[model samples]
Target chain A: MIALLMRDLRLAMRAGGGFGLGLAFFLIVVTLVPFGVGPETGLLARIAPGILWLGALLACLLSLDRILALDWEDGSLDLLATSPLPLEGIVTMKALAHWITTGLPLVIASPLFAVLMSLPGAGYAPLVLSLLLGTPALSVIGTFGAALTVGIKRGGLLLSLLVLPLYVPTLIFGAEMARRGAEGADTTTPMLMLAGISAGVIALLPFASAAVLRVNLR
Target chain B: MELEVSELSVARGGIPVLEGLNFRLAAGHALILRGPNGIGKTTVLRTIAGLQPPLAGRISLDRETMTYAAHADGLKATLTVEENLSFWAAVFGTGGIDAALDGFALRDLRARPAGALSAGQKRRLGLARLLVTGRPVWVLDEPTVSLDVEAVAMFVRAVRAHLAGGGMALMATHIDLGLDEAAVLDVGPFRARAAQEDHFDEVFL
Candidate 1:
């Protein structure tokens, strides 16, 4: 499992792996919001949490196809399926790799991107916290989508259609937590729900993803 | 290790492609599946490899004892040859890509990225993966799609050595693999017939 994770990470770092594209898209989205919404600080601060959350989600989505498509294309997925390692473990490692390559970077760069939207001081910690707690769910859920569409040609649009619906709960709770924190309101409920969603997804989705992958490979 | 396939049936797109097939391959032997294109040669190999469920019948083998190599080479373009082989080795809980590199004559290209290799070189790398698997049985599909005569000879030598070492192989190919004693299973006779009479049976019932 560690070997698979390490190899995927190494592959992501290499050229054409789209390592920095997610971060670049995040930056571009956040930077464009102020110009489109105008430079009014109050309005920017008001929508900052939502905008940041949306940007992170889209950035994560942009790279979801990378999770398993390459392996499927190159036939590594087939060999991996027949190996001693179970498909569940391979799916888990893929989600972990995707999180490391795409989700983690979005979290790390969020604070910098948040400034462009004139995010309030309190929004920073809550934003980072919500993202840290929530992005794993994104990666996990996106992996399921990737597995489903791995066999199809031009699966990107279809992947978004499949995964974006699943992202709703995470986005609602995450954005709510950040918004409540920025407003000096209690954030316990949304925060706990966000963590619950992440924990549940992390615990359960690999089996589903693995099952889908087996069918696709067949 | 013994691979037993009894009355196996396989389908593509919900329609049966091959049916009522039976074969048993014992240890230290090789089986070559020959047929024209689209006759389900790949299907039989895949069914034996446990990649998909047979529509009907049984395929029994020790799951951990088999490794499959499909048409695609499964090589990561960006990684070096050694990195690619070593990754599979680690995944299979085996080591010694040095032997695999030497077996495929890939020692000179060990440092080069897989994307830089020619078609034949890539196929060699793919074939070399079978060795690093360290498994008793090999299920290979079109193992020699793009190889020169010399490369083909190298593959034949590798299979002979594997068999000599008590390993078994089941390959599907159009070209002759030069395994003098390997049993051949032609899938042409096993092609699934049309379902023209199923409606009558259903109506009578």
Candidate 2:
């Protein structure tokens, strides 16, 4: 599992764009929203939570294609499938790699994203926390979409079509928690649900990803 | 030890490909699967390697499970040649694939990314993955598709060495692999029949 994770990290790094590209794309989206919404700081702050969540989701979507497509193209996916290691382990490791390259950076850079929207100091912690709990689910669930579409030619648009609907619950709750936190309200309920969603995906999505990959390869 | 498949059947995309197929291979034994393209040669390898579910039958590799290598080379293009070998080596619980790489004359290319390698070089890399796995049974599909003659000889030499070391190989190849009197299993002979009538021409022929 460690070896697979390292290999993924190496690939992302070698690809020369995953980490920075996601972060920059996310930053651009967050930065551009304020311009479009008018330079009203108060308005930006109110919409900040939604903008940030939306940016995160879009950033994740941008890079999801690379998740399985690279391996499928280069033949690594086939090797990993046939390895003695369980498919579940392989899937978990892949999600972890995706998180490190895209999710972790987006989460880490959220404060800058928060500032761009003129978000208050209070909402910053919860914004980060919600992402920490929610993005794993995004990565895991996105992998299933990647697996399902890995065999299709011109699969990128189709992949988003398959995955974005499933992403709604996470995005809604994550953005809501940030909204409540910004208003100095308790966010425990939505935050816990977000955490639960992440845990569930981490545990169960691997089997689904594995099954879909086997189907796609066939 | 022998890898045995009794009454094996496989289906793909909702259609039956092979049915009631039977074969066996012991250490130092090689079985060549001969068939027309798209006739399930690759599917048969996938079944024995445990990548695909067999619709019916059992596959026992040395009375254990087996390993499979496909024509796609199963390599990460981003990783160096050595990293690819080491990854599979670690998975298959083998060591010293440096010798296998060196034997294939891939020593200098060890640090090169797989994407930079030519077609034949990539195929050699794929074969090297199987070698590094060092499993008791090998299920290979089109093991020599992109090789030049020299690389082909290198592959033949590698297979010979593996068989000599008490390993069993099941290879699906169109061209002759030049193995010494391998026990060939012509999968073309075992066609599935909708009714008994489909077998009339086959039986009479």
Candidate 3:
């Protein structure tokens, strides 16, 4: 398992690795928001939580197709299925790698991007905290979607349709927690909910993704 | 070790493509499956490799004893040849890739990214992966698609060596691989009847 994860990480760091694309997209989206909505600090701060959440969500979506498509295309998926490692374990590791490559970067970069939106003082911590908690769920859900569409030609568009709906609860609770934190209101409920979603997804979705991957590989 | 497939049936897109197939491969043996294109050769190899469930029948082998090589070589374009071999070696709990690299004559290309290799070299890399698998049974689908005459000879020699060491191989290909004493099973007879009813309900569910 460690070997597989390390290989994926190494692959992501090489040329055309896709390591920085998600971060670049996140940066672009955040930077462009103020111009579109006007440079007013109050307005940027008011909608900052939603805008940041939406940008992270889209950034996550942009990379979902890559999780399984490369392996599937090159026939690594077939060899992986027949290996001693179980499909469920493989799915889990792929999700973890996706988190490492895409989700972790987005989390680390969120605070820097949040400043562009004039995020309130309290919002910074919550934004980072919520993302740190929420992005795992995003990666897991996206893995399931990627597995489902890995066999289809040009599955990028369909992947968004499948994964975006599942991102709702995480986005809602994450954004809500950040908003409440910025407003100096109670954030415990939304924070807990966000964590709960992440936990449930991390626990149960590998089986679903493995099952889908088996069918697709067939 | 023995691989026994009894009355195996396989389908593509819910329609049975190959039906009522039977074969047995003992240790130190090789079986070559031959047929025209779209004749379900790949499907049969996949079924024996346990990638998908047979529509109806039994495929018996020791668990985790088989390694499959598909048409695509499964090489990562950005990684060097050694990196590619070592990753599979680690995944299968094998010790080193020295034998695989030497077997495929990939020692010189070890430092080169896989994308830089020619088609034949890539296929050689793909075929080399089976050696590091440390599995007894090799289920290869058209393992020699883009090989030159020399590379094909290298693959034949590799199979012969594996068989001499009690390893078994089941390959589906159109070209002759020059393996004496290997049994040939023409899949043409096993093609599924076209008039069979569709299993639409089961497929969707």
Best-to-worst lDDT order:
1, 3, 2
Report clash pairs, candidate 1: none
Number of clashes in model 1? 0
TM-score of only chain B in every candidate structure: 0.93, 0.89, 0.93
TM-score of each: 0.96, 0.93, 0.96
Given candidate 3, what's the lDDT at residue A40?
95
* Candidate 3 pairs with clashing backbones: none
Q: Where does candidate 1 stray beyond 4 Å?
A: B195-205
What DockQ class does candidate 2 belong to? medium
Give the candidate order by descending TM-score. Answer: 1, 3, 2
lDDT: worst 10-residue window of model 2 chain A: A11-20
Quantify all predictions' global Cα lDDT against the true fold.
0.92, 0.84, 0.91
Question: B1-205, model 2: which lDDT tens digit per residue?
Answer: 8888899988766667788999878788889999887678888888777667888888876423456777778777778899888888877677788877976889989999987999999988888877787676878888889898899899888888888888888999988767765887788766555422345435886
Q: What is the TM-score of chain A in candidate 1?
A: 0.99
Report iRMS values in order: 0.7, 2.4, 0.8
lDDT of 3 by residue, A1-218 (tens): 89999999999999998998889999999999988989999999999999998898889899899999999999898889999999999999999999999999999999988889999988889889999999999999999999999989999999999888999999999999989988888899999999999999999999999998888888
Off by over 4 Å in 3: B195-205
Give me the runs in candidate 2 sitting further than 4 Å from their true place.
B62-65, B194-205
